[model samples]
Target: MNVRQIDPKQRGFLIVNSHPAGSAETVRRMWEQIPCRTDGSGPVVLLLGHSAGYGLATLLTGLRRHGIRGVGVAFEGAETERRTATAGWYRTAAADSLAQGAGHDFVFVNTDAFSKAGKHEVLALVEERFGKVDHLIYSLAAPRRTDPETGTVYHSVIKPLGEPYEAPALDFSGDVPKVGRVYLEPADDEERHATEQVMGGADWRLWVEALAGRGLLADGFTTVALTYIGSDLTAPIYRQGTIGGAKENLEQTAADLAAVLGDGGRAYTAVAGAAVTQASSAIPSIALYTAFLRTVLGDGFRTTVEQAGELWDQLTGAVPLVLDEQGRIRLDGWELDGQVQDRVRELWADPEAGLERARAGADWFMEQIRELYGWGVDGVDYGRPVETTVPWPTPGVSHA
Candidate 1:
């Protein structure tokens, strides 16, 4: 099967295909960004859904900065003869290559993290390979989840909670980009519950319990589930919506998990900053907000990898962990700055001017979206053909 260059195009909030070389280069560059190296003697970490985005960021930080040998679980599609693989697939492949080159012990388990079988497989691997897990980071991002026990499917929604919400949304799927108002109806009870089921802490709890039951949790074990609580500007569609309800559930779950762990063990909900991620790029409300946010922050804007490095420093005691009233790690201080919010509000109040201001950084934002799918990356010629069937170097055992 011949695999050629994929011209990633925006369709609504999703990008179409991926480029292998671009993804490898992206990972290589991210690896170079962390100049400080470790002796591969750090904690053994387990990261869920760590193919791309924040999960990937944390995984790289632990491996590069802390010299942690670890395993990552993610669900990514492989490329076929007619179509390219998912961007995350290529990214994982690239990460594996980098790890091997650096003589780091890293593995990628490509499977459904929500499945009981998948959990069992990973647990067994950990027992055989790492003996115990020092830290578990839950950063899974999926549209839906299937209960391992009952096989019930739950789908997450992004609608508001009680009332219909309308906000400025950005559209870059067409030739001419535009910013316009988008109206969304509130989520029904079923949808909200389903969203919580999919995005909440239930699965996180299960994983922790399963690990503990198997005697796989290390002494002083700790866990953190990544979350976001954006500013009021995105409250209607984000923090005050179904997603917010799910996050609340996640945080509560963290508390419960911490209680069960007892004796020096801890659990936390890490509040992360918003950025141009594959998931957020699909949400028009978030897209519009981030565009303006990038405009306002300018050189101050921190990428996901940068934030992950900070989080690693905080979590590992290299620096103090800043927690808010909720007892969760706060990494979104810059985005929530009062002065920054005031400026974003000024832009939001006037869509025309906001779009104009955001336009100056539109190239950057769009390039981010493209880079998510391994397109629009520098030092790579998109016109050249690339191998699509790049194999995952350290694929883990599959229960099925």
Candidate 2:
């Protein structure tokens, strides 16, 4: 794993896959576990938020295996132990790419692109280096935020839009997580707009315009931003909530950006399957949904890496990416299959059925959450001391 310097002051940081600490045999084991596709420079890709466990990191690795040389992200928030662990995961991906001799180079800029200045810096960095990228993959989530341009902050609400929607929520305080119908508050007009402003496609549009205006887009450049639309179980706060409105706006942005991409380049809102991530766990009712999903799908519950591999296949002409009637990419096919949803809804409908299944399988969901936080790696010895510091410079200013 390697990182490139994107700026002189170090306000931007990039961290990739890491090399081993012990014997050469250990290195070999690490490589053995990592996935590397045979050969192909698939694309020069710019990722806005490619970090571990949320799909982008694995997507980059998969593309490198298929011959994607340049990969980078204009990322934010890399200070905690969790982000550091993810940096190590990225390092492993890079190591695997090189070991396969696929000729891979990745970019990771640790800076927020929500602000006007941040977007300019990002575009400059891309224009100066990668020139024009073949694809742009953006997968990001945050709470309340404002447009840096207007200096008007908008807060994202987790509440339902019209009426309070209740669903079985995952309660984690116990030794064994339990699920029961939980009611969430409703959102007002202002709250709904706030959710859209913060979680919506406005920031995504900013990034795309920045890259495209600066002539940083390759011919047929494709861009995608990940979204989620859970079953009726999460409809209130997810599929039909204020957050869902933001997703709709995001999809609309996809349509608009697709027009701008023009020559074979398309924009898509790739709705992903349910899985635990730094972003999703914080949302209400998702943990419960994921636990039931694990019970129903078993081995079919996809991690970000697996889903990303499929996405690369679709994008690189290896396979066709099926779309919904609305034309957006439907990556959540497996999860949203009628049969699967039927069973999931059944579990939700029957309290006893849902609780029993959750009791059996909720541990998997919880463990995956721990893994996202850097707890479940094979070689990691929590008993030992490890470095938690990063070499990159951070924005010295404090957040108010």
Candidate 3:
């Protein structure tokens, strides 16, 4: 099927495409791209959350750079009220781009991961289609979820402690930049747990167990979960904060998954460097930090695509995995470089001075942010309107 010919308005089917010949060719090309390690054979890789940011980039790198043609499972809700049209559109576009670029088949599943039955369905599909999966990448970031245990749905909110905390907001309403203080309210306990359920390791563990139960995990298969360890300055709002706890749980879950994989399989937590993704933009203090980090680091920060390429290189036996003092894979080494962190510390010590420097450096930082959204990605035709169907997997939708 011609992926580019897909309809843009269709949103209820989990986009599934069959490319037997193309997928076989992709496998052959991957053999040529990946360097042989005397130790073992290459296995098929499956990627979750394969439509955005790191997940999408990883899918691209694994295919275009490593020659690994694998399946991508992206879940989209059936009802318009349950899903955002904007997100569905972007994901479909990304999936189309990936399938077209790599010449591999992609299966989109439209189901909520918060339920046990939904999880089982995805596992079944993977087993029936791929048979075995060599590598798994989990990268889901959502704001709210319904607690299966309590039967209560929680919605997340971005608020501050005590009376609404107000901060200077940038006005993009005019040609010239104007600033105003924006008020934020604090989030409640239920809201916090809902965020955790949606973003945390519960679904990750489910995916691992489901795959293993189906006997789809190849021996020595590797699974990775992306995480972060921000500085103490943002701890109250980030690391130690609500989302912070979830990230910690995710790391711990990775360790548990490793044990489950036994001696042959391994699990890694890649402490990825900060990059502007659609999800990251929603965080309160992250934009300011990212703006500052970009200003200070200039071209040092790696793009999501670059990071994914590096990750694929390491996973494919091209580069030796580097671990930090904490024993976690150091994918975000640039973020923790002593020199860089020291400068960040200096800026944190004096907010006024830091803001001055960041504002002065805004141009370079803005450019980097724009490039991250595929604005300046070389060889991409941004002017042309690309179309793809939203692969919303309804039970009645035919697989073929």
Candidate 4:
């Protein structure tokens, strides 16, 4: 083990190091926040891309609230002698430790979830140990994906499809962060197709098919892909962009997956609200939008953990599973509320001025960014020497 005092180095939206102590504490806080635990029994879940964002939230919510035991597949860098592990890597380790202490079965696979070998490895594990996967959560997000069968690499772009988009964007790449206007060129047919191939539902569908073909999926199997549909303010660069084209394909894929699941099974896209996630932070105007959102939503803003818990309740019949007119699960209702949008519009009209009024929100947004990388959590000893090469608890099928 290598021990050193590590401090985060930020370049743009990226944080180079993660604090293990703080990461563990963040996991603990989320775990402890659950109002109550169930009978210590629930579904055997299989989560893909479950190391951060909505994926991580779903994993924790399942483990703590419903007593789920399962496998997670994600692409993460293990801690090395020269550098610290990624935030998700540390977060997974913390989750494994906690789950073990609580007597729950959880395993992590550190490999490329987008590859064929990765899929086969997970299938073999399920066949050998976990006989049935009751719930499959597809939370994978990536900028590029290579088709295992064809060797064709597709890269996703965030440009609008038909017309150019111009918006005020937030920047965290410098000592003094500021908001500035950004212009994006439109995507051509090929680029649109590539983006859809990378971020869309094809891979999601492939995973489900593979599991079902091997008889690994349980009866009445449930699957959901986490997604986002920002308000009209971000429609040009988001909901109406190339990414939107991908999301539309994803939603359609969900329907197709449901058909494959047959009568008893279910599959849908769970549209979640905007928050400060690594993926969202990389988007052009999201940082600005979320800062204002946090300000306007105030106490109403729901964290990914909270949203995951609600989704779990609906999935387990603990509460009503609400669906919108499109037959997709709607978790972004609060973010899209008429009153909420009205207030957000007041701020969106002029972000520079809006940010001044929403300073609290802006500050909260910045803190969330720090917290994601395990740097800004409360009660963590930054001065203490911490282990950077902490081993993953269970070695899954793939070698990290």
RMSD of each: 2.4, 7.7, 7.5, 2.3
Instruction: List model 2 lDDT by residue over 1-400, tens digit each.
Output: 3332221111101123221222122333434544766554456777666554444444444544565644444353333432342433434334444434544444455666577776777667667756788877887666756688789978787888889877667776756566555687798998888888888888888888777778787888888888888787777778788889999999999989888778768899887778776677777878877778888898887756667777777777789887888877776888888999898888877755686866766887766555444444466554554444344322222111
lDDT on C-alpha atoms for all candidate structures: 0.85, 0.65, 0.60, 0.86
Looking at model 1, report the run of 10 residues with the lowest lDDT sum.
Answer: 391-400
Q: What is the lDDT of candidate 4?
A: 0.86
**TM-score, each model?**
0.96, 0.82, 0.73, 0.96
Candidate number that wins on lDDT, 3 or 4: 4
Ranking by lDDT: 4, 1, 2, 3
Model 4 weakest 10-residue run by lDDT: 391-400
| Residue 233 displacement (Å), model 1 | 0.4
Tens digits of lDDT, candidate 1, 1-400: 5656567655755767788888888888888888556887788899998999899888877888898876899999987766788889999988887777677787888888899889998888888888889899999999999988899999998899899998788877677568877898999999999999999999999999999999989988889999999989898788889999999999999999989898868899999998888877766488778888889999899888899998898888899989999899999999999999999889889976788878866667878888877887899998987778887656553211
Model 2 TM? 0.82
Per-residue C-alpha lDDT of model 3 across residues 1-400, encoded as one tens digit per residue: 1234212222111212212222223323323443333221235677777656687667655655555544566654422432223443344444444445445444556566666766677767777766788888887666666666677776655544334444443332354323434556655677567666766787788778778888888877888887777655455566655677677777788878878788988888887888766566566666556666776787777767677767877877889887666556777877777888788777655655676776745444344344433333344453453432233433323222
Kindly report which residue stretches of model 2 are placed more than 4 angstroms away from their true locations once superposed.
Answer: 1-35, 38-40, 74-103, 392-400
Clashing pairs in 1: none
